[model samples]
Target: MLRPELIEFSLDNQKAELKIVPNLHGPITEDDLLQLLALPDFSYLCPLHAVITQAVIQVNQLHPQDEGNIELFFEIAERRDAEISFEIASDKMQASMALTAAYGGKSLGLRDVLQNLKLQRISMGLSKAKIEALLVEFATLSPGEKCHSVIANGRAAVNGSPAKLERKVSLARERLLQPQHNSDGTVDMRNLGAIIMVKPGNLLIEKHPATQGVNGYNVYGETLIAKPGKDLKFTAGNGTEFAANNPNQLIATVAGQPVETPSGMQVDDVLQIKNVDVGYGHVDFKGSVLITGDVGEGMVVKSHGDITVMGFVDSATLEAKGDITVSKGVIGRQLKDLSLSTKLIAQGQISAQFVQYSQLKAKGNILVTKQLLHSHTQTQQQLIVSDASARRGDLVGGKAEANKGIKAVAIGATADTKTELFCAMELTELKQQLKQLDQSIKSMVVAGLNIEAQLRKLPPKEQWQADAMMVEQVKVMLEEKRRTVVFRTQEELEFEALKLEIEGYYKHYRIDALKHVFSNVELHVGTAFQRTQREHGPCQISNKNQEIRFDYSH
Candidate 1:
């Protein structure tokens, strides 16, 4: 055996050199070697006057006629190899075999010479470590998980076979996963992905708690989402319909391309929400907090602009600098410390049973059955009824200490200082008492006595007479409540008119209303911003109670 193209030469120091110049970076195929070896002019460099002729021993290794041909083949191979400068990367089989057969087939240093070629590649700057990393061959199919895309080789089972290795399909998994093969040709395992691998008759699951079939996997034409809970858990199978698992924490797709975000962005972009539902965690947005769906418990939301919630704000504190508009009623039965801190404009009424310290405002008149619209102690805080509003407040406010009574419907403005005659003073007092009665009626509920808890026995009609007596007492109490309420209202209104005079000094008009805050984070509510007035129907149910008014000058 000889390499017809590789040549043998001697250096100045008389050291022999063997060289081969390969044209392309191709493995030496059998057909290529056959064409070179079949040359009739090949060999003849070696003259074998063997010692086997004298002792008649071991003549089987070399034929006398073939000695010249073998030398000629080596000489031509080495000469051609030197003419070009192709260096050997790997001397797999035929090159090693031919060189050994020509020199001395079982040479002592043959293995060492082959080993030096692998080292020579490293010294030439092509790291064997890198080359070894790139080249890999496997017998079985890949597991096919989506980790990376690397070139793969599927080789023939028989060694030294002329047939080529089958072309391998590039898979997604990082590892070169394979199926298990027994000596008797029994393949008992084949991997589908990291999660599942199968064999001929038995399936060896790679993960525990794994389901056995793909019965519940529902794949839409667009996306395949793994529903892990309930009866949706199923093991993956080998089919075009099934895809290998993608185990990334987040997969975001934008436009038709995927946008890979670098972990978390800056504060300006931390709370980022796209159109898709977050499905699990509290979805946050740096922009206006909008909930297309109902907010679950333990979800806190805050925003700079207004918060528009299409669902209930239950057990959750939704806040914003702009108005908070809740289309649905708030549900917590009673919010003990609820505080709505803006002109809370609601298309729906607040039904949290009772709010301890909460407040709401509408540029339009307020309308709510179980909600109260309280006046602030020190602003020009007054409940005024709009002409469009149908629901009226049982108006009450006064200051007993100042001995001033509130004027209903501007009985006296700052422009006019004169008082009316005392002709209908008695009738006006009775009318005030009746107005107080209405407020009391709005506040109270019919009592329900637990009959089982009745410890003292009394006459049946006695309970009814006692109720009647309580009613009369209530009438007196309401009248007194009205007087006290009116006194406070009058004093506040007088101060409001006075504050307007002071504020007018700094405002556009000689007659003024709004005060100027030198500094503070105060919201600038739109002057024409109208909050909803009715909770039930299309009527304005305003709380024009104290009847405070401060019309602004354009």
Candidate 2:
């Protein structure tokens, strides 16, 4: 028998070879060869098992000179487990697969790789051509190299769009619809923020329908339903109607100013004119009035709706049930005209560039773009004097009252311009009325007591003989007095409750002066008042603990 030690094993880069030394002492047998292969150290060279089996079978026929010289047993190429890893992007819009080279096993082909993918249940959006190409390329790749390719793609769903509505409508009959510019390149804000007017049957709004969205496909070939676009119906408000031909088209039913509201669009009757001169007379209209030119001195313009003056208003009486906007300043004669009162009254807001020597009142806010000089202005809401570009936008020689508050760039000019700002006047008035009601109630109580004493002094029904009618009259008077006292008492209670409500609102009252407040400026919050004899700057005034306090800290 041949010794197992005579067999030697060696390995190259990828080849395993074996050599055997000739054993002259005993002839080599198949059992001897099989015993040599069973050595534990040869297990790492298992790829050469088939070749070793053949060599063992031929060992008995080998000559001594053959000597089992070094021969290739097996090609030991690298063996790698077939890998197919998948990757998906965060947005789920794409997917990829990575293939590491598979060597030394049954040769990996396209069918094998695809079969493995199918077994892994990769059914959605599979690119067969791409997978085959990747497999072919992977076949050419060297050992230790990897291949990556996008395998599946997902489509994004298209979102729906909203309907478009016309924002602006043309008013060809009305001039000054847009602001005019002077030759010197300065914009004439006189026509700025102009009202849009529409005649009967004129188009006011045109609605465009929403567009339908396209459907999308996902990587799994699943249909992704897109959201349908929203549709809106025209909400026709007062004095508006939809066109007979087109439901989406809105038209004015009356010749008026077009106003946009949350519910719908409306047209209020509008009176348009070139100027308010002597020819225009004392214009009194039941609707809105638009003046393209100046309102001449002593002209009176009254309207149930808004009044817009594109030019200056000089010594005119302008009253409106709605808002009043004067592009230019309201200028009164420097010499106070006792006969003609220069006033501007509005149920809504009043906005003007400036006001001088005029009286203005509004139920809503009063906005002054420039100075408010020697004017008596009052509003139920705020009084604001805001001139952003001016160095000084002061309230000089004016008594300004507002129910809420007053905000001004400056209070009183540098020369001690005596400006008085009164805030929360409604509450103050309520309090005063409550006090008066209390006094009236007390008077009524005393009157009732006097009447009761008179009634008691009257003779009883059994003793009354001569003046029964007089006693009856006295009794009736006493009953009436009692009823009057009760009514007055109830009124007093109601007024007291109202006064409490007003006080709550008064607590939020504030007077803000953004810039300097000169001497002789009076600040009043409810009934509390403070006169600044010395200059104080950039402060807010409010009533705190029955005292008027000024906060100088910004």
Candidate 3:
């Protein structure tokens, strides 16, 4: 039997030599050398198979009777690669180590394996327990045996959340348009449920901010940044303010309907009424008026804000600081006493489904969806009589006047009903009224200037010495300040009114008859007038300079 000690390696283990002692009893076989090469101490050097075979043949060639020494030189190399190797993930979130028994070279220690991992930039999540376990297992393994295990891991980053907005009030206006049913199972047509209203200091909306997410790290010791949440801000509109105690909370500063705008919320002071009939007396309110039902004969309805009539207004007197919207018709009788006729006036626009035998006046436009028949319609802006959906309507037997423009599908009936359409005409009565408004505005301005001068002449409050004379002077100053406020308020109102009047006077005057103008229709623009000699189709009459010009589309 060949002993493992018979084989010897060079100092660097790059070369090896083996000696075969003559077996007096038998010759050495190939299996004998192979079995010797498999020993733990000598197995590190791989055997050259051809060299071993030749050595065995030469040993057998020797006569069994003659004993001799046999020496063989074997080629070998040191295993320079480490027994422990690492595999890292592309994202650096996982790392694993592979261990094997070394041959012809020194086996790697745990420190060596760790150093190799450091060179790969994997420094974050190394597990000492796993490394020690793998190293112990590697030590106990036979040559060329392999052991693989995970050694490191990493954390993933998380994204943040977005901010949220909470509304305290129901800003939906659909409920206002829908009629509610009574407990008796009957629909209250006149009482479309009460409008959403908010008093002063009532909460309207609140905002909650976003949060920053937690950060994470990888096996490479690199920081993973977290995405922060999106933040939001409260958008406050007119008559709305942020709460004194909470900056995130929004509140209303007036008693009115809560209107949701694109950017935020607004509060408009409004007066809601079921009807303007015998049950309700002559109504006068400082805010907008919402009439759910009809306004009966001789009923007077007035407001500082807009007047919205869900139902009809029949032979009633209605006035408003803002627009007037009649969902249904405005009906009246052409009586000898004009005061008995339906009179609807507004500082803003007036819109109606239909107006028959009524007097309509507005500083802004007058829009009629259906026919405006036998009515006296006056507006500083356009007078339009066309169905909004069908684009068809008639200005039949009416005296319609405007400064800006007029548009109608048909002017006068096919029966040649007399119709008058006037634009930019300077009426003596309107001129007088304008003059009176200008004078009133001038008077207020003068009074405001006088008040300012008087206020400036008064002693400054900081310089006043506390005494009986100072007290009396202070009282006089307060009274003058109150008077100044009153005059300033009135001046602003009058100035706005006058500005609107002047704006109306400087409009470009034009009239468009979309369909046809009957023969009896009288067209007037500025200082010029013309009567349609015959039925005209699709024509436009405009005041250019001081003359009226007609353009026929067809």
Candidate 4:
């Protein structure tokens, strides 16, 4: 075990000294001497150690009286100036230096240290007064004694501010005023408040300009470039445009809802359609959509904003970045007819009067007013099926999964349609992911092993005796292979993190059937799952003590 601390260098870098601790860890070998020659700090002294056996002999002869007292006395050369070793901060914002007194010659003056800094390319933020004081302090210290002081500091670069959008009016405040739920826990579907409308020439959004950031220099006088703030442009959709007088001001050209889009703010001018049939091709709009008639089979509607269907939707596909509201029923063919079956995916909340044989997925809540029959619905948030008017909403003959919770007036029917409901159910998905990660990691490990084997066989750049171009190409290839190994290691770290997360994470969720829960209804809560053999009037399903528990409310 040869340590770099055991080796010492002269102040002028002309000679070297080896120290021997009191521990007798066997005699020094050729390999030990070779290891010392390979160190970065001693690479400058490689010309001094040509013979490995001679260097090993020098190390083996160092026998100290005590392990603590291991400093060897070296004969100082004719005239050595004081050694100034710099220590720069990791962030390059501060720099300090330590002075080792000259052995048998004059100490360094202020001019000498300044010339040394110049040679080191440290031209910025020099403290001349501090250097003068440090020179005086160094004079008081004994020869070979060390004194430390701050020499230079650099200013850090300032990051620019991000562009901002200032809104004149807020639709979020109006939504807060309009309550979604009544005192009875039932949703107030009708009193959800009117849409926020903006008049012509009304300023919807105002943009602030981004400013350039100031540049800073390091102790080495190298410029540290600053990152300017991200600039944003107003996204004026239909019925909206930039102001004629001011480009930064976004104003509404017509009356419409002032909807905040992902890019910026926009006036959500609705696009009304009589029907979506074969005659009318797929509808893809940047704004909200309003359909008065039905969306016939094989039709597809996509919008960056919300999609509202006043009439029924039959075997159609509706994809919206915002919410999807269907006034009437959304009917679809069976899952067997995968191509023609209705599918609805929304980033926001989804609300429908009734959904049958359709597939629905939403980031927010999925609200069904009447019934969800044989539909596979999933939501990151809660899923509720309750009709305020009829007081009868059922989830039957399908899979309903939600991360938060699931609430319905009725679950399953007398026919025992094999309905399945899940709350916070992610075990299967996680297991599948683990399987994929395992496969990927195994492949990466094998590939990394092959790369390492190839690297071991290839000669290093220093040892190569090939053409310059060939050596350069080989060096690049080696670096690329090593980078692949590094990437594989990072992916392995991610895989381990996923495993740890799966081990520690537990989903907290519940399922509530306000009315009848018929037989053959399968309920899954977290990791616990069970099926109802007999009908239950009303019950709350949850996981307790790692087991599925059914609490009858009435």
Which ranges in model 1 have alpha carbons more than 4 Å from their true place?
Answer: 1-284, 296-298, 333-389, 392-554
lDDT (Cα, tens digit) per residue for candidate 1, span 1-554: 33644423355312223233222212233344334433543231222223213212222223343442232211222211101012221321111111112221122232343364444331222233433332221112121111111111112122121111121221111111233466798743322123111122222122222222222111111122222211112232221111135221121121111111112101111222322223545544443444544545445566543354544554455544333444333443223454333223322121111121224432222222222222111111222211112222111111100001111111112222222211111223444554565454334321112222232243464565569776565565556556555444443333443444433321221111112101111111111112212111221111122121233232
**Alpha-carbon local distance difference test for all models:** 0.27, 0.71, 0.75, 0.74
What global local distance difference test value does model 2 have?
A: 0.71
- Candidate 4 wrong stretches, greater than 4 Å: 1-197, 200-254, 258-266, 335-340, 427-508
**Count of residue pairs whose backbone atoms collide, per candidate:** 30, 0, 0, 0
Between prediction 1 and prediction 4, the one with superior lDDT is: 4
The model with the greater lDDT, 2 or 3, is 3
Q: How do the predictions measure up, each by TM-score?
A: 0.19, 0.46, 0.43, 0.44
**TM-score pick, better of 1 and 2:** 2
> Global CA lDDT of candidate 4, please?
0.74
User: What is the overall TM-score of model 4 with all chains considered together?
Assistant: 0.44
Per-residue lDDT over 334-354 for candidate 3, one digit per residue giving the tens place of the 0 to 100 score: 887753389999877788877
Q: Weakest 10 consecutive residues, lDDT, candidate 2?
A: 70-79
